[model samples]
Target: MENQSKKVTLFTPVKLGKFELAHRIVLPPLTRMRTVNGFIPNDWMVEYYSQRATKGGFLVTEGTVINETGHGYYGAPGIYTDEQVAGWKKVTAAVHEKGGIIFNQLFHVGRQSHRSLQPNGAEPIGASAIPHEDLVFTQQGWVPAEPNRALETAEVKALVKDYHQAALRAMEAGFDGVELHGANGYLIDQFLQDGTNHRTDAYGGSMENRVRLMIEVLEAMVDVWGSDAVGIRLGPSGTFNSMSDSDPIALFGYAAERLNELDLAYLHLIEPRINGNIEIADGLEPVASMHLRGIFKNKMIAAGGFDQAKAEDILEKGYADMVAFGRHFIANPDLVFRFKNGIPLASYDRETFYGGNEKGYTDYAFYEAYADA
Candidate 1:
């Protein structure tokens, strides 16, 4: 009874734009490299997502690259092809049959790529021609990223069109909506941060310039799906993929204000501690999301190592409208039920997280099965 009472705070239905969620628990976009043939969402991907689609809950698909050149990792899915669209339709159908609302996260990994992953051995594109020193996993193996070339002004506009087209493809694939992957040091993040984007054009340098690409992309996406069906993920002060801003609070605060004016579906902000799956920096009195919550006047979702108790606390305090679970959901398909009933979650295997078969993907036992064992 105590657990049930505590669960009420997190389980209450909330309005997120046009969708009324059954609960505030969100399954965040996790990059599981299970797509077959490098770009198609296969049968395993269908089974994988359907298992985690709890009725009345929200689930965002793994990062689906908008363009072939945007792909950085092996086995990640893409949305630009007709075959990929057909493949995702199966997954979305399965989730919808279970009464789960799913969103496809559109992505582009700017400079976070190797020549092996790019088309025709082309260099990866970014806001500048800077080289990222991080290693990325490819078909060949983990290789160091090559120096990227800055996208020309014409190319930038074309990339925005790519995002717009991807959103339309997501709709055709039967997604409930689309979430732009604007966080985690990806393409949009690369342009937004000063450390990577060193250009003096309209898409770099000043905060407005740095944020232009994302805003323009968002506007393009909104045109396709309407503002009510679009959401954006952001990581303010996130240092993943060697990314950092000159002044994150100022840059992100201004961005949030602009986003608020757009009246998009929601703003998904990853907590500073969970930046790029690594704890890079600390010592900010108030966290990034906390500061942005005061500035952005829209439904906000906060994610980053949040447990049920902490999630409940934040919801009760009105810090965010929803809480997204990542690793917890990875190991526990019925995470909402486990949290509500106080059931022990199954432990996850770290080795089988990325590119694997069914071992760590769909084999995690539910609470009932675990109890029987």
Candidate 2:
């Protein structure tokens, strides 16, 4: 038993805030575009998440809309309604039945949204009037929407309340914790990005000001769920939603340092790269994350193009405490096992990667089901 316990490399116990994770592997938040209506969790979502739960590691739910105005997808889950909380409760309960922990990732797409997805006649609100050059999937097909009115100071305060309410809803839905989706050019990311945020109010004009709303949101969530049960994800140099910063290093380094001061559960960071996997180039060797990781003594999770060899090497060198698997987790529910046993990975179906049925979502076979005996 002692040898078995000591030999558990990937299954080691790690402290993520108040929860003790049985493994250091995490299932990153992935958007499947499977929601049926404004914002509601479906049975397929329950099956999809429960299937991906690792016996040891943690699982973060897909980016869930916090309000009707935040609804950017047709099939994304929401935390604004009573029924939505009940639906997610079923999901969390099922994962708990298998002895796994899960957190709800709160999200709001700002300029990356289309008019069809917006609530009522309200335009899509952003940190600035600079609209995204990307197309959002809508019932009317892909259409260009103008930049939205900048959120007034009162509106920003309301956003903080929305975050708090969402955290409470997450608890009601039986999540072990909640993660703020502060990445991928969402509302929070929009505010953080220099190109998106050109305001001169207290929410912009400086690095500290740009990060004010995020900090307020975090504080509100902490008030609802406590600091130990909260986590935040950030993409320092990502250009997802027409996002760009004059000093990416300064923006993210400051954000990480502040997160460290808060002593939250974990800080998830997406590596910087334009296309494909983040290469281990000498110039972009996670200098900012390392600096932030040094400042923040809590659990640090890194995502974006991590394979088995790279993941193992990072762990062995202690670059990050936990590694989040995105596409790998999508195709292989037993991703940790596959990595540990050196089994060949089943490639994910690009066709069913987004806005699809259950073909690529839940039909991926496990090792035992297709083992070469």
Candidate 3:
């Protein structure tokens, strides 16, 4: 009876590396593409982040591009420029004002881009010159991703430097920590998975060479912010942006075990149920977090398709220390409070998920428990 009654509570406090949260719920990065011209965060972005902030809660900002050529969509925020850094300062301040811990999720979209989004119309750089019909949203509307050139050995090193500089700028922007976007078939994922990485160079042709870029990038980030302040997000079975791996379990297991040496903030895992940002019915591929929990052996945050019951269950079973809600947080600004108080959540409108003003962005209301009293 005692063992059966030992129900885990999401309202309880949990320590995640350098920070201690009042609750176990986390707001993961969600790219809404609502930044201003030149990919700068505006007042609307400030209010949006501020609205979601809670005392001692955690918020991971959307995948802020590290460089211009690394961008895959227009209006997606960047942290590379001085002006962009200034824009993010406002955002970080807003979240901090609410006493919320925030991290900048820095990334490069890799081959998930078109020539139009590149510098001087140069082909987007990736692990290799792989091309596919994975649509990247551009100024001209949804178009198939264009051919990308393989990054030379020297160019790969330069991109690691880019990540280091971006980490510095993120700290300058007043973010509490940083999460390297190594998932979702982005630059890092393109290097890790065999489907996208077809290079015979030192950066590929073997799992060590393939994972080297991501490991080096994380090492660079740790140099800026201590190991305790850095986190990594990975998706083992995620096929988003045409991603695949011949041996996901072996590849991801080795990567997770390697990550344990860093003693980083957390390993945020995206479930195989999630394809990119949306939930999908994937045939029995196994949950990525379940497969990786024991191997990573550090703080882990499981994301993708989690609700109140599911989130509590994961914590009870010790699969992840916290749960990240992207789509749910979009509709419920006071999501942490809702979870704490056992209140019903509002459903989100998928049509207004991307490239919108205040419709599905910041207009979500808080739960009114004592209305008409």
Q: Which parts of model 3 have CA positions greater than 4 angstroms off?
A: 1-7, 282-286, 369-373
Worst 10 residues of 3 by lDDT: 1-10
Model 1: residues >4 Å from true position, as ranges?
Answer: 1-8, 278-286, 369-373
Model 1 C-alpha lDDT per residue in residues 166-263, reported as the tens digit of each score:
99999999998999998888899988889888988899888889889999999988998889989999988877788888788899998998898789
Tell me which residue pairs clash in candidate 1. Answer: none
Across 1-373, the per-residue lDDT of candidate 2 in tens digits comes to 0123233345567878888788888999888877676457878888888887766569999899888888666677789999898889889988888788899999888777766788676688888887467656676544665467788888888988998998998998999999999988889998987978998999998999999999999998899888899999988788765678998888888887777667798888887742222243433465435556666677788787777666655666566778888888999987877876778998977677667677898888889943442
In model 2, what lDDT does residue 163 have?
86
Summed backbone clashes in each candidate are 0, 1, 0
lDDT of all predictions, in order shown?
0.85, 0.79, 0.87
Query: Model 3 shows how many backbone clashes?
Result: 0
Q: List pairs with backbone clashes in candidate 2.
A: 35-75
Q: What is residue 41's positional error in candidate 3, in angstroms? A: 0.7
TM-score of predicted structure 3: 0.95
> Native-vs-model 3 lDDT?
0.87
In model 1, the Cα lDDT at residue 196 comes to: 83
